[model samples]
Target chain A: MTATTPAPSAPVAAPEPPVLAAVDVTKHFAVRSAVGARSVVRAVEGATLDLHRGRVVALVGESGSGKTTLARLLAGFYTPTSGEIALEGVPVRQRRGRVERSYHKDVQLIFQDPFGSLNPLHRVRHNLERPLKLHHGVRGKAELDRRVRELLERVALTPAEQYADKFPHELSGGQRQRVVIARALAVEPKVLLGDEPISMLDVSIRLEMLNLLDRLRTEDGLALLYITHDIASARYLCDDVVVMYAGEMVEGGPKEQVIADPQHPYTRLLVESSPDPGRGARDRDALFDADADGLGEPPSLIDPPPGCRFHPRCPFAMDVCRTQAPPRADLGDGRWARCWLHAADRTITQENE
Target chain B: MVTQFVPDTDRPDAGTTSARRADGDVLHVTGLTVEYVTDGDPVRACADVTFTLRRGEILGVAGESGSGKSTLITALTRLQRPPAVTTGGSIVFYPRDGGPAIDLVTATPKALRALRWTSLSIVLQSAMDALNPVMRLGAQFADALRTHDRTLTKDAAWARAAELLATVGISGDRARSYPHELSGGMRQRASIALALACGPELVVMDEPTTAVDVVMQRQILAQVLRLRRTLGFAVVFVTHDLSLLLELADRIAIMYAGRIVELGTARELYDDPRHPYTRGLRDSFPPLHAPLTRLTGIPGTPPDLRRPPSGCPFHPRCPQRFAGCDTDLPELVTKGGHSVACRLHEPTGRPDPVPDPASGPASGPASARTEGGAS
Candidate 1:
């Protein structure tokens, strides 16, 4: 059955490789427990993702699901305990001097908090110019000022001069975020890793920020990794969706397929739990009852449950599920999920349909 | 327009009379105004907010961060600290035993103390802040339960505490764990269980589920609904997420610039919102099931309340605003059970034709997408 399924999109004539990719990446942090016992928090384990130019892949998960950890690994902030991080088909190495600086110039990370990202003492122009000078080494005040204004305009901060001179404290949350984006664009990076970029902004302006990111992707051919807990917003802006549970990637595919017909129990729970006002009370009541019985909190990373991380809370937990991790079951059209229910020998089409 | 403000002493029976008229009203707040007395001119955080919460009904107060929804909650519970004062308003509570109504604003400290846990309880956003960090979950619940009921023994209180925790889906044995030992979702559920330890008539939850994940948020909300159904306690759930309120709330009040701009049944607000601000807020959330489309959110930021817009606070950002919107302040007047404060809804204010729903700037992308089908 795996051999019968066609290759993902049958890339006509060898498609261009992803701008950035994490192959089987894992990160673990050592911490002391309440009793002073040493423990390891397995933040991310064997997570693989590829960010193609002009494409947005949303990393959707709960608070401690290690989506952010995967992003940080890709950003070169933390060296992976295992596996590899490749940029433009070249493996990235952990080093200081010029190689690391060059990697930063190619990939820029937009932090969640706009207020803290910028230097409070400097003007917006200074913040934007520092990157251009350090990364691109563009000398002369005239060139730097021009590039700074252009960056601001690219982010839709109108009358660039007005915003260029203002301090971080003077701008609104949305405006400050725009400045943050402008600073990221200063280096003309190939990949933008947004870590919950719009979560801190007001609800009304969040869409605008998403739209801006979308524009950047289309116009600049920049690959984007949008990390957010909001499934609806992810569906709105992301072309592909990746569902993570307990520091492991569970299911991933085209946004529509994954969101509309989730294969994994955890992914299904996430899609069902997202607030959809269009649902009637009767439907929600049934959903609530089903959720109340089976739903449990994400497991602790330090001593995660053996076998399937989600088996403890999964309604379809089988004997094998509690003893061993499930293998990845490939569904056609770039859809795949890690679940025993979708094992190759089992009939997938009839069950999923 | 400037009528003489009368103190609560003048209308001692106002609560009873209103409660009798409404019959099922658990809380009646009239002319609720809260202000922050700063060095400069005082800023009114909640201006003339008025609403009635029905018995066993979930009333959701939706607003942005600085839109004063939190201030309204604090003022309603009489938890506002110094500098934040309830300048004008009366919160009349109708006791379940059919006793005389007590005006919370004018009630003495001793009278308020008598009503604390037995009549009302609160759940804050941060469960760690509400729960005792160093104490066990069961002990905290016992403290609240025993303090309210002196007749109950320590063993009985502890048993009741375990039972309450069980109601919220936490195991009885887990109640012995401290707040830090539990997960974020468990701690939040524990705080909720503590709030209900006394079997209070009304629960004031301020973003109780905001700190948890969406899956856990659904569980917490479902538990609240189940508990409310069994116990028959009213709820005033406040959150900045309007979409969450649409599903959880029986009635929703949309606030902007320190005022209740619109109030109606959740269905009414969802299907056909009367106020422009309400419409914008409803459209702000992207639908999970609908075909994805470009959504143009409300263009501008909420006005700074210290120097709010001249007339209608929402006019500056309102796409459908007209000549009269900036000159005359519209009052929140009810028509056909739905209340809206906007010039477009006011009959005498203007005869301007309503903008075509399909032609509005925000309507293009929204109408292009199909309605979300049943899950």
Candidate 2:
């Protein structure tokens, strides 16, 4: 079969299709102080995202952008306060019913810190072994060792023998990251939700880890949801990108569309603010200053700016943005952004006024 | 329990300093050597490192952890302490006020302190440690002001503190806030404001934005750029992220082991990197524009600094290393306006101008490739 050659605005042809979907999901937490009743924290407010086989969908946002909450909702770790998450078109429910068990086996989540995720006292072999045994029902010491080695080798921590016996403390940052990937893969999950896995790594080695993930996505037919705050990394490694500002998907679709031609003011600010010394340092600095002067503090998520959560600090905020929430609209092609500027040759419209 | 580092401060300030430094280069040294006096054996930290920063220009020192980038910055700042001693090397800082040119390596504790916040201030990687946890941001600022000049009263110091915060884009209210109360970005900015609280002419920042995420990093960088424009302070910015260095610095110096392998205008260093090491590093970063390029990582780890490789420190990983590269240490020489320390760029042997494909895909290392007009 010939490879794809679509028009400029057309979606890139995929080797596979969607394997997991979170349809308009929302996860909220109640904050209760020592003497107070309860206050609602909209951890995730109506986030709809998808994970496709053999491709990567990057979920980009800064801290407190509802990324982790969204990840948990998809992983079945938290029941959505509203909305639904489906794996292969099946809604995620808590009970360990046979189908739910199988679904859990097929969709695994990769956490950011390996040190924090893994049990410190347990050896590497035991950590990888327990997951395989509980989910797959593998037994016998010999068979368990073989299965453990196979999992480690799959993640490229080669010789497997050397890494199998060591504890989490003994491994390097890159090795530890690989172990986390291996444990997640031990269940043979079809969809891998990587939540800022590379954000904690050394600059020189993070790319290597990302490429390994990219290889698994394309070669092994795995779907990846790489969650990160670095838009630059998201653009590089993801086929599609979603920019989340204050619990809503502000701009999303193909990575190229979102990064190269950002529609939302916040997305534009993120992409432009990065320092690229080679681009006439003076010019980049001037641009940085110009943008910084306008960006106030990130708003309180508890009491978000009425219309769009970003209205309070937006460089171009209209009165309307504070009163009413704007709808997510088509930003040409398959891409969508939730901002008034992209709404019908619209002037910077804010919901408040 | 502690040592004193003051040298001399009797010299009076003569008008503007950058204009009088005879212009070529102020901190001039050739074949400078430095080593760390570890318990058992001395560790060679910097060997034959040489470079020149013009009177008022910023020179970024780039390298990863243990790359000796921090040592170079600390050496310039006169803060290299215990175990780490300057085995050999001279850092001649041309004092602008008609004072005698001083050797930073031998400066006294008192003199160094006077030169410190007034002449050269350093903002370290840890914003938390740099600022006092217990003190109010206002008090800390006032303390710096009072230490520099005993004549300034509390009222004058407090007034200056507010002005400095405003200069750094922080509001007057922030002066009352403690370091912990402010966001990470705010704390970093406040620390920078305190560094500038004394009106230093030169600032050496070691991985200034290392801990913060990219967004905050960019904001902090923007503040630094604005501060430079307003205060006219020359900076020696050090960072491990080369991709970041591509945009914020005027000139960049790529360090490997203990010496600069490549040094040039930011554009030249990123677009046309000559050293094999530079090419290797450029390969490690995923470009912001490309969606599918598989970032090719340099296969092995950086060599152990204590037992550094012979010839070139990068020779261990150079994909195109030649026979002579293994035994001969290359010197940084200028060619086509860019200074590079690679045998390949020397006007000898074949003219190999082929760009390193390993750095990126067919269309890669897009350094300065995107002329962003986002404003």
Candidate 3:
């Protein structure tokens, strides 16, 4: 059941296996076209990601980039059309039975809207207690009360009793989200998949929520997959960053390396598009005007461009990009990018020149 | 009839002096107040708000969810429905042709109808709501144009609609499609084009780019700047994002709990914000390039407007609050171009010494004479 230990000659210790991993996962949704013909929406393709204990990985992209679909695949909401999801090195089948229930025990998904997630009719105490009873089988009244208070207090809802009996409507947006987090914690899951958790929060309170998540990761050794369209927030919280564009992982690496020196054109565009007041006013017009033609909307997933999905909008797209998908170019230190400009054989030298 | 609603411009405390009236000012608002009347006490949404917009200038209003930014916009455009009423104010909009300024609050229904798309127009956050779903995009534009100018024929209006669509980077052919046919970014751009259909002197946009992604937001903002330069229409843009405002707005106003706490040029608000709330808001957005640091966001939520805090609405959440802040309501005082409504920046009867502006939250009280004297 254990992984084979590394050799004595190896300097670094063997890292623990990822708690959750999605290998070459792809999802396709079928729909009827306007003309009444069957068609497939290629939502996600070849999305590979891993969430390790105490480490945070950010899946960053815009709307229609299939980041949510990838998260759902990891959470077992959708059965992947191809590839597999493995938990703790064991492959998981997407069947609706005991296997799925056990998988749900180890993983949880937090949605964007806290108001919609929690039942308005139920009290906060009932919300937190049901998960504990179902997941851990704690039946006694006293035990349930103690555990519920602990969950609320862990999320900084002080005194716990004040909030336990309140309905979801009585709480503020941030408080409601904290209650949502408290409910997620009651199950004591090892992996948390947050899909735009803080995007709905007020700007003045978003950092507090991020800090809380970071504290949870450090204290409980939980693996987190943070999905968001905002790159700035991802940089603030994640240990590693993965950039997705048009249902593909365009670039990924350690947070500092990938964000500071992005290799893919889409990643570069994203990093530059994030608003930075330090850039000041003088160069703003130039920054925005220069990319006017290149700022095309994301392609339709139903009939995406042939080879590289980004080729049509990419400024540096070559003939090969239009005809053939480029292989991953290694940027060293575990950083890589899917781009023709970085490919070793064809255009790297020309790009440098 | 409109002259009856216009306040005496010669009044000493009108906030609009003869110099400002004669200048290139496009819109001047003074003592604007809005309230939401419930069965119980009325909830004041906008309290004595005042500002002026110059020709081709961009004024950004930034605040959180309940801070009344949207209410101010509704009041400014005279678009508020029942339960929301503008209790007091004068919104004087000056025509570009050197005509006498018209008071929007008191303009007749016929006069207001004449000015809706010609002198002032609005763009909302969701383009789908602003645009007609059943009508073709070209038809919508043509309807707006031909209605405003009765002399224009349908064919001429359609041609102008295509050109207007082209200005926002949408292809002329796409004008035939319906609102639901285009992408989200394209639909938003079409709304902006529709707002500019009559060449209005002022455009009031409430979070126009909030629904789109950052790349599209940048493109839309860039087009707005370009169009402003060519068309010379002033803008009043409202959003909850301070960082976006810093890059796009010429001047910025920070609102909290139905009042403007700070107003200054973009550079002033970014570099030397006097109000503690402004500083906290600016820091709440994590920097993109600066070395990462742990930021403690402002601790408390915005005050409830129904039972607002005694003095300053932000004092409960402000880290630099003092004993006097609980009782003394500070008036907005302007010095040079920057204005703030914080006791920390006020000059008279100061209980505590002013803290240094450079040293952020932890800096202890220093001599009050430094920046207080400047104000």
> What DockQ does each listed candidate score?
0.54, 0.39, 0.45
Q: What is candidate 1's TM-score for chain B alone? A: 0.92
lDDT of 3 by residue, B175-232 (tens): 8999999999999999999999999999999999999999899889889988998999
- Give TM-score, chain B, model 2: 0.86
Q: Which residues of candidate 3, in runs, are more than 4 Å off?
A: A1-14, A345-353, B1-20, B357-375
Candidate 2 on B135-252: residue-level lDDT in tens? 9999999998999899999988998999999877899878898998888878888888899988777788988888775677877787788778777777889988887877767778
How many steric overlaps are in each model, in order?
A: 0, 28, 0
Of candidates 3 and 2, the better by DockQ: 3
Alpha-carbon error at B340 in model 2, in Å? 2.6
True-contact fraction per candidate equals 0.63, 0.50, 0.63
lDDT, candidate 3, A1-353, per-residue tens: 22121222212222767788887788999999789999999999887787888778899999999999998888899999987789998999856777887888899999999989999999999999999998899999999999999999999998899999999999989999999998988889999999999999999999889989988988898889999988878878877789999898888887767777888989988888888776655665776673484468899999989877899888888999999877766666667788888885532311110
What is the C-alpha lDDT profile of model 1 across B163-266, one tens digit per residue?
98889889898878999989899899989888888888899999998889999998888898888889999999999999888887888999999999988888
Error of 2 at A259 (Å): 1.4
Error of 3 at B154 (Å): 0.3
Per-candidate TM equals 0.93, 0.86, 0.93
For residues A184-268, could you state the per-residue lDDT of candidate 1 as single tens digits? 9988899999999999998888989998998998889899999999999998887788999999989898787889999999999
Model 2 chain B is weakest, by summed lDDT over 10 consecutive residues, at B1-10
- Candidate 3 is scored at a TM of 0.93
| Candidate 3, lDDT over the whole model | 0.84
CA-based DockQ, model 2: 0.39
Q: TM-score of predicted model 2? A: 0.86
Candidate numbers sorted by DockQ from highest down: 1, 3, 2
